[model samples]
Target: MLARNDQNSLRRTPLYGLHVSLGGKMVPFAGYEMPVQYPAGVLKEHLHTRTAAGLFDVSHMGQIALRPKSGRVEDAAKALERLVPQDIMALAPGRQRYAQFTNEDGGILDDLMVANFGDHLFLVVNAACKAEDEAHLRAHLSDDCTIDSLADRALIALQGPKAEFVLAKFCAEAPSMKFMDAGPHKVDGIECFVSRSGYTGEDGFEISVPAGDAERLAKALLENSDVLPIGLGARDSLRLEAGLCLYGHDIDTTTTPVEAALEWSVQKSRRTGGARAGGFPGAEKILSQFDQGASRRRVGLRAEGRAPVREGAPLFADATSGEPIGKVTSGGFGPSLNAPVAMGYVPTAQSALGTQLFAEVRGQRLALQVAAMPFVKNTYKR
Candidate 1:
């Protein structure tokens, strides 16, 4: 849910009217009319999600299916591995993994999710970069593979501690899912693809259902006492607090997975000394950085005071430092932590835990310290 100014040409999600009726403050985000916050405000929404379950409409994201004409699922996986650094061939059926598309120069194109659905590969890319991702996939993949865009589907994220409890009422198998596990299920007679994964660093499920059944499923989920509608504002704050990256902000075309502290997403099977190594784009550069660390790395920051240091705030080595050492990519008040939290890139030497730094905000330098994320503990059911 990347925030943007309202545009007259913005598209609407399947749940747009439902959001409006629930007092959601609609705004443009990723070229769609999305809800940034509701009447409950961001503060309450963020806290409530930590205590209960929050339903998020993430239908703006692009969902794609890659199938091999020869009917070999491994063929589709191998083709996808050519575009991303993850070991797609190693992914077991009904499982998902995080991955990134890299450019020839080792810069990140976009971060995405790849799931194995037994017969085809399921992909979920960021809304803003979906079109470009599709184009890149079609141009590079072999003729034997076919790319299908799932435009008639909608995605919903049910996140937080109580997510499984509420979802299990409709689907008996919801509570038994482990993190990153995905499978087909029926929720209140609506067929859905359910994955026990989310962006909030909590135990949850992401459901992909037919667009026509989106409202019905959402309404049924809301019937649970623990489930409440959450908007983009709290969603942003929650992910930030969880130390997750926002595509355009914390990561982009100019940043590589290594520089963005995402080397873990690149599996060992694709790295040096593995059976299949150096096959993806920019393999030389990305693998080199894995051995010799990146010059600058992304790190979490904790402010000294309650003042929120926002994105673009210049970071300095000390209070009276001369020039900016780095800049804040994502920063804001974390309601769950009851303090200001942020994430940004800094020189590797200054990225260690407890390293002291300063941020320039409103012409005054405020003290900041490199801290360990997440600001709130992750409660995933691993």
Candidate 2:
């Protein structure tokens, strides 16, 4: 059984009661009471999602809609382009793209997903950074655009190899949707906005439904024989195994998208020699890094032993001595791999695919090596 808390100050998602009833271990995260694991535990949950389907309640994420005041899609896209380096204007309707909110110093404010919904742009950002993102958008965007916060909605993610099969049972068109495709759909008569994208490097869908109908929708999905409720614990491990970065941990306000190895998100149209170039914040600094390369970069690490080198662990060039070279940002045991895996920042010279390094953990040194990411291969539906 999961532990219960009497604290009433923390915010609750629409599925809070359902989680409690299902043996969810509630914990405080991003100002909300969310489940970190269920009775099955994180390890089982992680492996289960890999084999079948796992239902995730991600209602803590912030959802926003940007509508152009003039009803011209170009207006809203243009305004957003000023904040991100991605070529928003080129985004086709019903398609989604990954982007970051860059700062003047070339640092990342927050990474988010942008979906062009024909008349408006739908966005999903980190819950912790949502308020700041909204404020920044309002302060920078022109009066020709309007930003609306979708505070009355809930977001659910169904991920795994069987995710498509489970979701297709309710929405017939779901199986035909390709990766990053998003549009309106009805599941059991409840209207929802479904996206064929997720953080877990797996074939999945993220459904946005009204808060009032969230429980009913969740219950229906849970009744599936192949579906099980997953929580934050497994979610973190899954994303880490998939080589995805956590907002504040791997990529933060101090880290630029280029340094985080997210340059692919910045389209060529916003780069030099493209149709529209260099309009986003910190364009000069970011573009320079793209040309000359960054001093440090994010890299994946594989532990030589079974001991998991956790986050905040300092890294060194030598096992016994020498100054620290870098630090582990995200680290833990990868259940699927049955080994210790981590991601961190290191000097560009030491960021090769097989560079040897050592991690300091509890006064002991653990051997580590720079490795390619997605520790597990992605299986997105093309």
Candidate 3:
């Protein structure tokens, strides 16, 4: 999420003023001025989210609407299927699914969330790739669908064990929403799109509210003793602990869904010989990899020592190996595990559990082992 260019041109979210008042450290990210962490700092903010709740301002993300010309949501689903490999048609109303926009080579352009809102489809794409994603949709699916960017809405995420207990105070429907359940709901009299899903591996909700009401709602949520204002620093660490991918670091145009260990997201209905299979972009290259597995795969690495192996650290087969076989994409100290964990791409033979590998950090080769992900347990409501 690092922006190397310039900081002056960065855009600010609707909650920028509120973030400043809360003592958030603003940083440049994906062309926006976002909070990296509040005065409580990353370590405490990360742990607070695990034990109680954390309020995140995710308005930098792109929100778009896809409405079908035929006035049938099924038509919109069919149009979306042409771009993604997910079973969008099978997505029932008021439900959401994870999907990726693939290129001709099966490489992921960007990953996003698709929710069926009955009248239209709502999409939440990454901030950096949102422009391209919207353009991609307009270029391919505009013939039968109306593509509009929802610039008036802001996205906020309340994540943790007590998220429901806090949100249910204003929105009564929050308790009944199972995982992936999403639709328009009134939150403090503000009609917003609420999804029972989030980037964190905890039971939480992603609320899409009007830009004007974002500040008030966030302040209200923060009034609770358990909800703390978290920033990008803690957000990254939390998601990293959850073993979730960070778009450019973990996946990009050079990596495919199969290689990223996200094959589970590509539903069976869109695979092999299923009824609606092979209709999306890169269908040939992607589906073939399912049969003949990918050469490299993303795997979790648990450091043998307390020292954290940061991203871009070269990974070697052994401490004696001169060249590198892989590289760390996202690595950090896990607050929950009280140890260092990392994720990176490695050969299939070395991706198995208990495989010992070495990461070259500074001048030392640190011992690490291929380990299971979600370093912390996921408590999503089933």
Candidate 4:
């Protein structure tokens, strides 16, 4: 059911052929003709990753390095903190943190991963924001920090309950790393940096290696009886279940981190009245929002029916109809939840866990209740 020739209008990953050979259903994603599912389908693919181990081709993401000429970590980190809210200066070497790039208006430009390597800051930005993010960094960052896009590298994720077990076979030392810690390692003779982290809220590793070596390394991973090649379709469901945001969908230029339920990502020291207030982009507006409290807040919703409510679905305050309050950002059938689940924005009054709302799917209003995120418990290797 997959057509390789349909890729004429889309970009191709180096492992495109390998994905097809592995029974992947190729689909257009972020300008690339990529795998959306496999022979096992999205449901099974999602479950497999939770129960066993699954590998994903995330090379389409943008990898970048920030190198300070003097190799001063504090200088580079302090400069980066000017654009992001994370305490980059406090990120210990070999550790990583999730952060967002802010616009002048205090809105999130993009959410990205930043790792503190000994000599440079390693980063993974969303694929769709690669060009704009780099441009933003170059235009605003301190002159001491140089931005180098690692366009020649490919990224893969190995995730599941048994992730560390499978990875230990090739890199025994990897098992010691806690969630969000990354370091250089050799897995089955392939040199790569593996981070004990993932978007699915499962124990996993994201491996960055030379682009040319991705296919070979992928093949090696598949050789393990416990690992299967997962596609983007399942990736979405997994992350949705994990309560992770997808750049363009869950957040964008108009969404502030505070309203997006990402206030936790903002360190207390950076909040209003703290030592660092309003130094980053839109600091005044962000701090003001916190002081005044945002009218709307992001929340998780579970439908009372089996029908799925997808992106752009209108959310109403009451099942009968009070008024249009918000809309669904990410929604789908959650294999783990055994029902339809969604995440979206709603008025602060209606964002509580037991608050009831209505989602308009196909013009039919379905009862939905505000639920806690990570519908499934996260089992990250601590």
Q: Which one is best on lDDT?
A: 3
List candidate 3 segments past 4 Å from native. Answer: 1-7
* Order of candidate numbers by lDDT, starting with the best: 3, 2, 1, 4
Model 4: CA > 4 A from native: 1-9, 272-275
Q: For model 3, what is the error of residue 231's alpha carbon versus the real structure, in angstroms, after optimal superposition?
A: 0.5
**Could you tally the backbone clashes for each prediction?**
0, 0, 0, 0
Candidate 3 TM-score, true structure as reference: 0.98
Which parts of model 2 are misplaced by more than 4 Å? 1-8
Residue runs of model 1 more than 4 Å from their true location after superposition = 1-7
Better TM-score candidate (2, 4): 2
Per-model TM-score, in order, reads 0.97, 0.97, 0.98, 0.96
1-382: candidate 1 lDDT, tens digit per residue:
2233355778888999889999999988888999999998999888889999999999999998999888999999988888899999999999999999999988889999999999998999999999999999899985858999888899999999999889988989988889999878888888899899999988899999999989989998988888889999999999999999999999988888999999878888899786688788888888999999889999999999999999999999979857899999999999988999999999999999999999999999999999998888899898
Measured with C-alpha atoms, the lDDT of residue 357 in candidate 3 is 96
Clashing pairs in 4: none
Worst 10 residues of 1 by lDDT: 1-10
Question: What is the alpha-carbon lDDT for the whole of candidate 3?
Answer: 0.93
lDDT of 3 by residue, 177-198 (tens): 9999999999988999999999
lDDT of each candidate versus the true structure: 0.91, 0.92, 0.93, 0.87
